[model samples]
Target chain A: MKTIKDIAALAKVSIGTVDRVIHNRSGVSKKTKERIEKIIQEHGFQINKTARILALNKKYNIAVLMPTVESSSDFWYLPKKGIEKASEEFEMHRISVNYFHFDPLNLNSFKDVFDKLLENSFNAVLLAPIFLNEAKERLIYLDQRKIPYVFINAELEGANNISYIGQHSFDSGALAAKLMSLLINTEDDILIVKVRRDNVHHSTIEDRISGFKSYFNTRKTPIQIHEVILPKIKDQETINTLLHKKLTNHQIKGLFIPSSKVSVVANYVEEHKLKHLKLIGYDLNEENVHLIKNETIDFLIDQDAFFQGYEGTKTLFNFIINNVVPPKNRYLPIKLLTKENVKYL
Target chain B: MKTIKDIAALAKVSIGTVDRVIHNRSGVSKKTKERIEKIIQEHGFQINKTARILALNKKYNIAVLMPTVESSSDFWYLPKKGIEKASEEFEMHRISVNYFHFDPLNLNSFKDVFDKLLENSFNAVLLAPIFLNEAKERLIYLDQRKIPYVFINAELEGANNISYIGQHSFDSGALAAKLMSLLINTEDDILIVKVRRDNVHHSTIEDRISGFKSYFNTRKTPIQIHEVILPKIKDQETINTLLHKKLTNHQIKGLFIPSSKVSVVANYVEEHKLKHLKLIGYDLNEENVHLIKNETIDFLIDQDAFFQGYEGTKTLFNFIINNVVPPKNRYLPIKLLTKENVKYL
Candidate 1:
């Protein structure tokens, strides 16, 4: 095993300089830090983590930003449960957690939450980053503050966050497509429902639709794909009208909801007596479970939302208590839920 | 949350004495310890765990005892994997672990392993405690030395271990009965096979069978429950003779192997071209998966052996590092595995 001395020798720097860079101390010049890191990586240098943790004796606080569970959707509730469990376990080690919530459909709600959290002091942050542009603006301030943050549930581009904990959006969509294919014939039409407020962009939902299209396209299946956008102010009556019109106009064989609004689609399907159509959607809420038990929804793709919060808090705790930087991205295992297994969960 | 001072006042001890007992310090006398504990329980005192950990600085070494995983039955493999993962994450701290392995079938093997581990010092111990009498004798030494140990997989009587991390045996069996009830009719005969080595006692297996029988017994089902025991030594002719005689005499609809030897039973059913016998067994190993995929094994009850190892190691680490005592017994979630959900796992 190569030691720190070997990297220092190869980098043409003093041992102290190498040590400073390795520990991420601020005094080392950027050029020297880069050179030392390159040499260390090339040599596969391994540090005795025990000694490193013993040297660092500071506690840390992590701020978490996520959507609050409301009457519209309860998908965020599971993740909150995970976060609370992690907080209780880590409270003993001087690791404090502060949670901030925003409305999923309102970009301004997210912006306001981010602004308040940035003004407060925190060692680290974990953000869902639902709005692309608003999240980008917050990332700039986070960069200036040099506070490491992790992305959960959604990803933002051009941000130097420490890690990401969520699902592979595209893969999840492809999984949904496969489940849909099992219930519907190749020539049938499928509708993809995207639910959001009128002026808000949902890139995560778009990613899922892209993945769904990609899978069907590769399979050479002659399945017609349609998209439906519902305004945030739309009630069940408007949704019912639009869905009934679409079903009557086209022989819609399957309905795919790309977000947690599956419950809305499920309720429409049940009320309109459209039990013949196959439905695949996201998350496990009370509304979705009723539909699943009744066999109205063929499958529900779960991203293990609870784990995102649980692992995010745990990672921050490990960094604070053990002085360790874990992997930059942690992808949770994708789980497919059906009626048979849903009861067990 | 009542503070330690309140308990001290009620017990007529100094605040320092209460603090020492709460932290498990060695200086507190037995009479004071009992008095303080009684007062604490009466008031339902809860400690500020964060403050307690911050005030104390000490390292701990915990020893683990369990059966080694054999190729024939890889039941213990998952627990070992869980332990290894925890060890990697915890090596940076003052927590070190030593493992002692014994043959699951032999009582003498467990005694020998325990004797050797006792020679070396450990702050705490985690054991499977498969053999009740042998474990009782070994635990006497632990009590004399004032060492704390945890039980996993199985529990021993009259031994005051800190905690037990494993499944509730009866609940697991009840779950199996529910699954088996789904496959066969109430009038069909069911066979219960208890396979074990000659030297090993089958207390857990017996408890499982008792639970399985209780389900049918309460429902007043006409399903005939037959018991079969095979010697530890592998003899195809002997097993074949017993199986052939039982099958010829009765119209067996389901076979429930109350141990990890379900694969052997699965092999017998396949070899003899037996049909219409729904097989329910325990654990997920290479042999069992093969039979499960081939539709020979209908269901397998998984007690989450991996979590037993993971949580056991973590509990000991927390106790040593944070001066915390976990619950007396931690029951892992019982999972029912079938062909439908096996692929996802």
Candidate 2:
């Protein structure tokens, strides 16, 4: 709340002299300017910038890196819509978002797009890391240039990042485990099915699995846990072989599919008349919604994809326009969706 | 996005005439004013009121009504803090909240405070309804007068109100039952313990029970349910007798208490070494938190009372100042809380 006049009084200078020091104008003496600057910094006197913003009408371009929406899973579509909403809201403020999507299933597809993005003069970026190691290495240049970047959906640990807006995957995974523990019987074995159709175990998904295991191990729950991995869901032979091997081998009571591709598993469950088993999945995409409504899937842990996208874009815009640093890691609330609450969320 | 000049052009008048009409000045003829007003309404053109707001700088009073935070169960305290936060955030915008507390255990106490609130000239109100029928009846007058009101924790159904921001109790109950169905055995009896220390069968509680039963009945889940209603949880003989009878009577494997006073039952379970029973309760108070961490309680459905309070005050302020109509029923997301994710929410 300290005004320029207050700073000038503390520094024993005129308001005009303080203004010269603030704007780095030539009229003030070097000694007086230094004294006024010291006073301004000491008092944390932030001049109201609304007027200055109008005077210096600036346009900021932010790049958004995400995955192409897949029909098998349109989970990324919600976040895309969120980004669009934020972009439209901030349009009058002279901020524009340039979306650069990559193939979520292909590592080289992600690298190729990020490589092209490095050539642009964008103010900041919000990204979802698909190829983890390479994406972190490529983003090192942004850190060196002090161009702030935010992560959405997928977070990179022990990296130079401005902010992360997504669910805490490990905690979310643990939550899924807690849900699984609630519904599964001790006599029945639980399966941790990795529908690795993308041929990638993203860190977020890995952390979720780790967290899920930690929850069960910590409490020493007596239920048996089994693991199975399937190739790309589109590969009929692979899906059939994996499903047959797992389903025929064990008297599975519950299945935990950590990715949004739970819809794929839900399909197989319905087709095979495996209605006795309890199922916990993720995200609330159209396919998941239908399966959940029919009771093929019991509970879903929603990552709040729309909010993640909005906050990611909003955070980057804040840093570029207002120089405000968002919370380092903003963990979105983990929402458990059931037959009754699914429609509301 | 329409301007005064646009209205003036359409009305065949000068900008001054339009301005005068907008400000309700006497210089303009009534016919000209009527023409200009129609033009403004047709276009959804809003006058620039920032200058008028500063020129008229008026203070607004918002009344907050809720149960007093009980020393034993501080459930109401979270909402109180949220209201305080929203009040502080809007202080510079010329808004203040005047709290009217009531003993939640007594119906007459609520009537007394509401009667006192009715005498005040407050611009708006945000309330947590207790003794539902009476509260709704008293609030009808506010609706007739067009003084907007928002409901926070407990919502009124089939009422004249601006907005209701709270968790959907029935859906939340169904969610709890879903969780309970997951953890409880087919042969085990589930106890619906009504720790009615408050001596009110709040509709919120009844709705949650409905939702719980609906989930079990629809799914045809084989768990048997038992109900126990206690007038006062603090009465030692009653608590002891009920606990003894329920603990001894059936093959009880899980207990469901749809209130924040879950701590009362949790304490009994811990003291009597009834750790095998899977329990699903509500809220994230200190005692329930400890029980969850120590593995005595299985899961706690978070109502997010803080967000409910903040949104209630904020929504009323928006309507009073900006004339924004909030969603009629804003159901806060239901969160399934565990030891791992409790710290984050």
Candidate 3:
């Protein structure tokens, strides 16, 4: 029930000084700011976010930089839907989002999109740092320009981002391994399928593989694990031959696909009428969901990419408008989906 | 960019009428409201929620009615934490929540709490309709009094509640059964344990058992299933005797506890040194979580009771302030947790 005036009076500071401290404005000295904050905390004083937003009446522009939906196996499409939903909700507050797409394969395309985004004076940015080196440089420039950004779906190490909303790739991979272990016997060997494509986000996939291996390492009786890297997923005959070779050579009972391109291998399994082979993969894309429904895929570790984009945008806006500091890493729940539980999710 | 005045002029209605329609006030005619809404939708006109809330400047009192945290195996404790979180967040908006607790053992206690809540002038209500018949009568009374209520943790059939935010009991059980099937061989039999206590929430437990049975029924190789109803969980000797008899009489490789009181059976298993038996149960309570961490419990079907309480409270507040109509049944994701994924969750 305490007001700003009460906080200022208690702290022996001017109302303007208290206001600056409340808004996280950098005018007040550290000592004065601490005193005012102490009083506010002691009294449980709340800054009226609704009134503050109404008073500012400022329009904010947010730039979204990520690969196009068509750029990476339609995985970005789910997050795009989530972004649009957030856009519709936040539009009431005069917040507008402009999207910039880059091709995941081409470094030139990534650079061009970053440059185009830099041309605009945006209040904030939400991006997936898929191209590590290029994204790091762009992020430094953004920091110099004093524009806050949120990283979605991908994290760039040591970047000055307000928040990174995504999954813990390594933990998710470990979770997938746990589920896979439950499906197959200890003696039965497992295959880790890496469906290669141009511009594949390698760090996430590699972390997942590491996590999967870590889980098995902890087990008393370590199961035999094999890896098969397919050069390109588009060629059906080539994929069939590669997978056929692995299955025949080893007593493989389960397939663990580390990326959203799980449908490619799922299609191979279905076409070859491979029975009793438990398939576990990532994402809940249209094709992945269909494969899961038909029992081609047994378990899926959903990163909830939709929530990453949606929460990333919302977090950026809250920081810009309300001076709310978000957690540096907002690791979403590693959701495990089967056909029975998929419908509810 | 369309203003209220523009909407008013375009709808051929007065600005006051348009305002009333937007606020869902009863004074505006249905036809006029629809016409104004049509124009607003066509132009994608957004009503600034922040400005409207600031303008209203009304303090809302929400009444939360549920069993005490100590009632029924400490399952309500998780949701209580979630409710407190929502309370802290919404306190900034002059929205206050008052909690009313009832003893789960006594129906009279539930009636007494409802009566006490009815005396207060609450803008909204959030409750768990654990006592079905009693809740139905109270819900009818609330409908007559025109106070919106959100159901959390439990649902009443055919009630005029604004939203029911919780897990689908049947589906969660089915999901649990799927996990159990993966853990044990098809030839191995399973035991369903029901820990009995006074004022047990029978509906949820029954639905879960039905869901578990349904899953096995769908399988081509039907596994033998047995049920054990422990009269009370306090006496370790009694629990040990009953479980010993079942395990000795059958080829049981898995134990499915259909309630939050899974720790009782988990403790029995640990004490008896029953190895290679998969223990799958419900909830993320302190004891269950501890059991899972030590590898005593294999899999947990998390209802996410925290989210249920959190979303239930938020939904009620949005309905009261922003006139947001929530989906009647907000079925949360049936989350499966193990030692590997439990930390991340």
**Candidate with maximal DockQ:** 3
Candidate 2 residue pairs in backbone clash:
A182-B182, A182-B183, A183-B182, A197-A232
lDDT of 3 at B195: 74
Q: Which candidate is the best by lDDT?
A: 3
Residues B192-284 of candidate 2: C-alpha lDDT, one tens digit per residue: 988664556577888888899888999786778888886676686788788789889558888899988787788888888887887889998
Candidate 2 lDDT by residue in tens digits, A109-178: 8888998888787878899985688798889877666567899888898765778999999989988887
Query: Model 1: runs farther than 4 Å from truth?
Result: A1-68, A71-73, A80-303, A310-345, B1-7, B10-64, B70-73, B78-100, B108-123, B137-141, B199-201, B270-276, B289-295, B313-323, B339-345
RMSD of 1: 9.3
Per-residue lDDT of model 1, residues B1-345, tens digit only: 477778788888888998777655568888887777666656666666787566344556788898877653578888888888887887767567788998877777888999999899998888888877778888988877878777888866557676788877776776678667757777788888777555456557766777788878887888888877776637878888887777775568899998778988899999877867889998888889888878799878777788888888887776666545666668775665555445545
Docking class of 1: incorrect
Q: How well does candidate 3 score on lDDT at residue A330?
A: 86
Q: DockQ numbers for every candidate?
A: 0.05, 0.42, 0.54
The full ranking of all candidates by TM-score, starting with the best, is: 2, 3, 1
lDDT of 1 by residue, A1-345 (tens): 467778788888888888776544557887887677666656676566676566345566789898887653488888888888998986665667788999888878898999999899998888898788888877888777767777888877667665678887777787678667757776789998888874766767877888888889998988899888776535877887777778784568899998877878888888878778888898888888777878788677777888888887787665545434555667665566555446645
Candidate 3 lDDT, tens digit per residue, B192-278? 998765454556777789999999998855689999888776788898899888889558999999877789889988987886889
Best of the two (1, 3) by TM-score = 3
Better of 1 and 2 by DockQ: 2
